[model samples]
Target: MSEDLPALMSYLDGLPEPHIVFDMDYRIVSANTAYLREFAQGQDVRGQTCYEVSHRFQAPCDQAGESCPRARALVSGQRERVLHLHHTPCGEAYVNIELAPLKDRRGRIRYFIEKMESLAHHHGAPGEQGMVGRAPAFRATLEMALRVAPSAASVLLLGESGTGKELMAKAIHEASPRASAPFVVVECASLSETLFESELFGHEKGAFTGATSARVGLAESANGGTLFLDEVGDIPMSMQVKLLRLLETGTFRRVGSSDLRHTDVRVIAATHRPLREMIAQQQFRVDLYHRLSTFPIRLPPLRERREDIPLLADTLLARVAPLRHLSIAPAGQHRLMSHPFSGNIRELRNVMERAALFCDGDVIELSHIEQALAADAWESGAPTALAVPMVSAPVPALPGHRQAQADAALWEAAQAHRGSRAELAASLGMSERSLYRKLKALKR
Candidate 1:
């Protein structure tokens, strides 16, 4: 209201930090330029309080247990700082806020100061620690890995797909005594079945077709650190013999070389398939299996460890936020927990990353979760029709409606039209995509 306040506001507004003053009622008495750009919602935010504009919550700061830094600043006279946080709907964009006591010339407290410093957490890059859950199985496995990481013993990670085996292997390497050494990964399953040995062991120059020059295999590439063998179960039966021999003798020759090369490389192998079963079936060598299984660790599926969903969700949301620059909302958390993530940790990360990429604002919503759920449906496999028990006692149709005599009528109609999939979908006001999905389920 005073002419001097306008001049003072102009001066403070020029600074990069978002700053503002709030009256005793929590109303925004005045704000700076950065504050307008950061929190403004089209209309003026000056007269409104923090709660009214951002949270849309009931009552003022105290009664609401308002835990944010801005709310604390408005209440206390002392200055304080908060870590990464958001006062808006989206949680991705971060800004640290500082509050200071404001006073008039007459020595009376007129308002409080709120200054913001932008930050980037509650969202950041995933280090070697991508395993986010805090389940007992996870903790125990981590402890076991850390214990063995300092030693040079080979490790064999066994778990279903989506359990983050590669992540665990990297964590072990990073925590090991040989952290400075190289950590190389080789996908045993991806190598061509005919050239598995040449891929793992360095080939001599002119060794075979397309061999222009000599090259070091993964074992030689990771001389001192770790060599992660993903999907070890898929290693061809013939190559398994060479691998076993290399592990036992610590020496292996190139595909076409006679000289033996020795190396000290820690091997960490992972597989989703049943190795013991393969051994029994004569598909995998028993000697090779034993050599790789010196120290075995298995990761539990997400469903078996449901309690860690929230923690994993938070970790993933934080991890996903920085990459795509979007935030995950509390409302989307439930849907994430409910969905059966057959793809496991990898699925969770992919879903979250997708949500961040597709979502508009900093805050992720239910729609994002829905998008993630739909995208992963194909990977989860189609549901089996009639396998799901029908609802008991479907007696009659609605009071004034008579589309079908009973709910079963709808099922029959869908089945009858199932023959002409497209025409059936159009007749029933359903999508062709939905019809195909339903038909697949019925077949299953």
Candidate 2:
């Protein structure tokens, strides 16, 4: 601490933007009110390490590829700036950070002042542009998307259903050179073999019974733009060959015509099914898979990136609040985090929507979430006993003895395999939220 520390702190606290002062050791010495409010959730942050607060890392920033700005400022004896995607109390946001060193009376660098400006507001809301996450898995996927966005290569997005593959494809298009042009989406699963060619390659007048007039298909309509093929795995073998021909030559004639029309369009495809397995099973063409997957990006499921749940929930709530006039209580958020969202973002959105409708007051509580989840369970006819699969042996009927023994066995099993709540819930054939509630009740 220096004699001028008090004055410096006062100046930083008066500034509007979030700012903090850290030592060479990366310990946060002081943080402005704005910084504390945004990052610390208004908790006491004195003496906390910067890595622990910002990244929840045991080591320093440099070890995690986020080189310490203070160290850079100290070496150069000048201010330094870096862009970082950080997980904050508000959500995951891109922040522009400026690091300036403060010197002691002896001219020795004592502390570094860090001023953070949020770039998310200026650019777009987090998760608004189709993707929203800060987890390492999600970050890696986003990095890949950005790296391949500028190129005209065909991108194949692989992920589970409701993992936002279409959104990622759209992101690629929005960042590409042909962003000004149309970005057409075609759902391959909905098109039949007879109509697939006409739907994608247009149809001439009197092409078929339903073809009343000439029509331009999605591929032609997407000229000089991007064409997204959703559920590519569902395209029949006959249709796959036509799609491959179009991708290979960029030329296709409308049905019932031999015009050999040409259209320059970038192709992006997504599928939840394992296309490699399909190829091995002789269901999908290997050559077409190679062409479509020039740049393959696999999205991580929600369970794999559970740390992003808070930000995701916040973003979802923000989008749904205005329409529903309802807000989620902290308890409601906890319930959401505990659940294994099998349908990923889509499931979360549906849950929130249902909760909003069921909520009587402004704040949605645990009961509202429970009712929504129960409704889903009822609709699906999911059994409650499925929550404990480890106890497979059926107990003998001995008055109330069998039921009591089964409960004991389930409790023991839940305690043993508690490493991953999601995996445990899956093994027990129940939602993670149900498992959490059961464990909480057992504790009581």
The prediction achieving the highest lDDT against the true structure is: 2
lDDT against true structure, model 1:
0.67
Every model's TM-score:
0.57, 0.65
Each model's lDDT comes to 0.67, 0.76
**After superposition, candidate 1 runs with Cα above 4 Å error:** 1-129, 321-325, 378-444
lDDT of 1 at 427: 36
* Ten-residue region with minimum lDDT total, candidate 2: 385-394
Off by over 4 Å in 2: 1-83, 86-92, 95-129, 323-325, 384-444
Candidate 1 has its poorest 10 consecutive residues by lDDT at: 385-394
| CA error at residue 97 for candidate 1, angstroms | 35
Cα lDDT tens digits for candidate 2, 1-444:
577788889998988899888887888889999998888888877798877887778888888776567667777999987656666866656666778888877778888888886644312134544567767787677667766877999999999998889888887787679989999999999999988899999999998998889999999999999999999999999888889999999999999898999999999999999999999999999999999999999999998887777677656766776665566666556556667788998888887777677665676655465555545555656532123233222122323543443345446545444256876666444577977997787778
